[model samples]
Structures are given as structure tokens and as C-alpha cells.
Target chain A: MVGKHCILELYDCDHAKLNDEAFLRTTITTAAKRAGATLLNLITHRFEPQGVTGLALLAESHLSIHTWPENGYAAVDVFTCGDQTMPEQACELLRQELGAKNHALKSFQRETPAALATAVRHPKA
Target chain B: MVGKHCILELYDCDHAKLNDEAFLRTTITTAAKRAGATLLNLITHRFEPQGVTGLALLAESHLSIHTWPENGYAAVDVFTCGDQTMPEQACELLRQELGAKNHALKSFQRETPAALATAVRHPKA
Candidate 1:
């Protein structure tokens, strides 16, 4: 199956929120639900001095975020297979909750070789 | 600090290897070490009948893989923040271990807003 992957670069996020492990875990878990994905498990880590990293494992795929509190930056990835899930929605939720002043988002498709062949043969289909 | 993120799509792989949870865990751990990343924790889940999903949490960032044994396809993501780490090397190791006959790889840098501003102003520095 083909999947949609979104890479989000959140800038000028709230430093406190970026370093708050509990908040991040809640936000990521909520983001997964917002994307219409099935949450299998959620894991998070808090760095020694600062920063936080989290991953939300979903039945469709996975969502992850690595925050750099000192820089007011956070990098997020949301990937999901199946047409039912909207990975973009998850990215948007994270951006909003993190209070990013500015952000850059890149979205792409992950297709298997068979899917690529099908797209080539049936460009309109 | 700026980070490198690599997205790999492996196709035409061995179905048995794709579904082997033990092998995947070992391979991903080894890939992280090869990239000069510090491993924190590893978590994996095997789906009913077939397929597997694994994540290697690293001090630099994280590496993850999701396999589809039925279609002989797998998707991998390796992201690392330190300049000393090589995300590409981890991706290559995974590609080899998974035995993907044909694969597609995309790599990019994830820079924070501060870094972006510095890059734009310095231009050559």
C-alpha cells in the first residue's frame, strides 16, 4: 500500500512546551487520534539538560517528534498508510499545540514498486 | 544543530526476512550503531499473520522500519542530529540487511529557523 508522509519543521516554538515531556506525550497522542490513526503505543524520552523526543506508533504507520528546546525548534514526522487517515491533520495539530511562530512542511508519497508501476501504466487511473 | 533525515523505500525484498521480528530488531540496532548513534531503547510489534514494525530510539534521533511481507515491501526512516553521525550509512545497512532488490532513497537536512537565517545571511560562511 502507498503511504503519505509529512515532514514538519516547527520554528519559534514555546521553549517550555518543547522541554515538557508530559505535554509532548499528550500532544503527540492527541495528534495521532486527530489523524484518524489507531494508536498502538506511545513512547517518549526527555533529554538530560533539555529537549524531548516522542513517538506514537499507529496501526496505519507512525508519528514522531524531536524537539530542540534551546533553539525553539521541533522536527515532526507523520506517516500513515490507508486512505482513511489524514497525516496532514496530525502535522497541523502538532504545529498548533507547540505554538510555532513559523513552520515549514514537506509532504510526499511512499509508494511500493508495484504501485509505481501501476501509476506509470495508468497515469489517469 | 541541523539534522539529516533519510527516507528509504525497499521493494522486491525477501518476505521471510521482512516478517522476522528477531532479525529486524538486530538489523536496526546494528544500523544505529553503524551510524554512530547512541541507542536508548528499542520497541517492536509484529502484526497478525505477517508484517512487522520496529523503532530504534537513538540519542541523536531515531530510526524506524515498517515491513509488509505480503507485498515484499518495507519503509524506513533514519534521522540524526549530530554532524558526526551518518544517517545515510544506517539507511545503507538496512537496505543491505533487508535484501531489497530495488530501492528508492531520499535525503534532506532539517534545519531550525536560526540555522536557516544564518545560512541565508552568511551564504558562503
Candidate 2:
């Protein structure tokens, strides 16, 4: 499995904007669509004080977000295993939608053990 | 917000073990509790061919996993923001529960913009 996993820390977003439930939901769903992820289910939870967590379960993989409005910060994680998913493009879309001033991203390539072992077996080939 | 995000790629797990819905659900839920995360909601989806996707939404943060049993592989994402949460401990728990032969972990620190910006402002204090 080729899982292009992307984790993003979005900073300095508008506090009010970060707290909007609808915006968070739609933005993640749209990102899933942009990434070519087939939506299986979507859930969004709003905290008592002021924060939101949204998760989109997809056939290809999943995308999730957690926001802290008080600090105007949001954390995002998008992992897709299929070949077609565009998680990076989705990140750009989210940065714009959240009005984040700056952000950091760390991505990982997740492969199956068999594949990794196979690579180790044929280091030169 | 200090978000300690851990993403794991578990390889060569027992396929039949991965297909057990209850185990998948409990593994994640327990991991949350171990991390001192308050459970908000939990959901698990089983794919047709042979896989499972579980998401545990916690007040402190969230934990999720997607399994590819055919490859003896699983992908895990655990993000916790509170200072009390012990994400690494949870990882060790999962590793034992899944009986993963090998695994890879990549972590990121998610900070609120104010905190990150403040650091940039004061370079050294």
C-alpha cells in the first residue's frame, strides 16, 4: 500500500473562522473530493468552550482536523493509500479556506512489510 | 496548543486479527484512554475485501487506523494536544496489541500560531 500521509499544523488562522463548524465540515469534505477520496462517512464535533474536530472516512483513506479557536490554530491529518489521491492539493485548499497565516507539513510514505522487505532483498536491483 | 501527532505504519500484522471489528475498536479506544484522552465518539468501518478503518474522536484529540489485511499492513494516526496526553505510550500499547512485526513512526509538533509566532519573534529568550 502506498499511503501518502500528510500531517499539517495550520497557524494564525482567524479565531472566529477556526470556530465555524460548517466551514470546517465543508472544507474537509471538499478536500476529500479534491483528493479523489470517496467519502464513506463524515463527522464533526464541536467542543464546549470553542473548538472543532472533523473526520471524513473515505474508501481510499481518511482526512481529519482538530481546531483550537482560542489559539487560532488547527491540526490536520490526511492519509490516502490509493494511487490517485492528491493530499497535497487538499492541504493548499485547506490553508486558503482556514485563512492560516503560516503552516508546517510533514509527510510519510507508508508501505507494506512485504514491499519493504522486497526492497531490502533487492537493494541493488 | 502542543499537539504531539504520531503516525504509524504497522507492517506484517495478522490479517485475521486486523479484520476483528471489536479488537480494532477497543485497541483504539484503549489507546485513547492510555493517552488520557476523553472519548467524544468512536466509529469503525469494515471494508468489503478485507480491511477495517476505525476512528476515535477524543476531547483532547483523536486516534484512527486503517488496515490493509491483504498486505498484512495497517496505518495509524494518533494526534493529542493536551500536555497530559502520552501519545508515545499509546503507540507501544498498539504495537503489542496488533502484534506488528515491524513499524515506522513519524511525529510532528503542532503549535498554535501565537506560540509559533512568539517563538519566531523572540528567537532566543
Candidate 3:
């Protein structure tokens, strides 16, 4: 299967009042829906009164988010397969929601076995 | 805040013989440890008599795996930041564990916000 994934590292967030748990759940569901992801199940854990983290499995792929209340930072990862661009859209939504001042993002393409073999022979610079 | 992530999709797996739930948990933890991920908390769900899926949040990043017992297929995603290549290493371990004959993989670089803005303007063809 071929897929695209995005990893986001959000820094300088205002976590003290961002409704951590709610934000995690809402962001996952909303992003999944917006990207037309077929969600199978979701589970979230709120670490006492400090941080919150969650994971959602979707037919298209998956979405995960974590928050650090003390440091005012968070991280998000979204992966999707099929005819959709939900990860990118979700990133935009998260950017707006967190009111993040600065961030670092990365993307990866999971290559098929055959292609990967070829890639190893001729690595990308 | 730069990181790397890998997404894997396995097809034609042996679901009946393979221990779905056990595999899910083992793969997540082992892969995380091998990748030098700092474990935080892990949660897994087993869909009665059928499939299993799990998520592990690591200080380095996160690991997620899902198994489709009926179709003998599974998907795994591993992402890590810092001076590590755990995602790739984990993919290799998974391939060996699942006895997967064929597969597809892809990788992406999530440019920092500033780089992303530049990428958007220049675009990658």
C-alpha cells in the first residue's frame, strides 16, 4: 500500500488554556472527517492535570496528537492512504487551533517494497 | 523540531496463525525500544475474534500498528525525531517478524514552518 504521512512539532503553544483533552479529540475527529477518513476507533488519555494524548485509527490511515501543558508544546502526526489530503488540511486546522507561534514539520512517503528496493540501490540525495 | 516517520502496509499476511493482539503489543514495544524511543504510556485494543490495533507515545515520537485478521493485512506507522533512524529500523524488524513477501514504503521530510512556506512557493515536481 502507498501512503503519505506528516509529522508536526508545535512549539510555543499556549497550553494552559487550550482545552487539551477536548482539543485532542476534536482535532482528530474533525481532521479525519475533513479528510474523508473512515475512522474505526479512537482512544485518548489525559495525563492527570498536565497533558493529553490520543490516537484515532481510520480506514484512510491514522491521526495522533499529544500535548504538553507544562512546556506549552505539542506534536501531531497524520498519515493517509488513498485519494485524500486530510493530513495537510488537518495541519492547517491545528495551526489555527493551537495559535502556535512557531513549528517544525516533516513528511514521508511510505514506498512499496519493490520501489524501496530500487531506492536503496539509488538513494535520494 | 525536525523528525522522520515511516508508514508500512502489509498484505497477504497469515492472520489465522499469527497472534494478532500479542503481535500488536510486542511489535509496538520492541520497535519502540529498538528505535531508542522513551516509552511514556501504551494502549491497545483488540477487536473481539478479529482485529487488533495499538498506539504507543514515545519521547522520541510515536508508534502505531493495526492488524486485519480477516484479510491477513496490517499497517504500521513509526515516527521519531532527534538523532535517530528508528522508523526505518522498525520497518525492517516488522518485515522480518511478519514474514512479509512484498510491501510498499514511503518517506517524507516535514519542513520546518519556514521551509514549508518556501516549499509551497517553489513546489516539488
TM-score of 1: 0.90
DockQ of each: 0.24, 0.25, 0.08
- Chain A TM-score compared with the true chain A, each model in order: 0.89, 0.87, 0.80
lDDT tens per residue, model 3, A42-104:
776666445566778766557887665565667788877654455788777777678788887
Candidate 1: which stretches are off by over 4 Å?
A: A115-125, B115-125
TM-score of each: 0.90, 0.86, 0.64
In candidate 2, clashing pairs total: 0
Q: Poorest 10 consecutive residues of model 3 chain B by lDDT?
A: B116-125
Q: Is candidate 1 or candidate 2 better by DockQ?
A: 2
Q: State in Å the error of residue B11, model 1.
A: 1.1
Candidate 2 residue spans exceeding 4 A from truth: A114-125, B114-125
What is the C-alpha lDDT profile of model 3 across B21-120, one tens digit per residue?
Answer: 6666777778788877766767766654555667787765578876655555667877766664457878777766776666666655544333222111
Clash count of each predicted structure: 0, 0, 20
Write one digit per residue (lDDT tens) for candidate 1, span B17-111.
99899999999989999999988888888886677889877888899998888778899999988677999899899889988998999998886
Candidate 3 lDDT score at position B58: 70
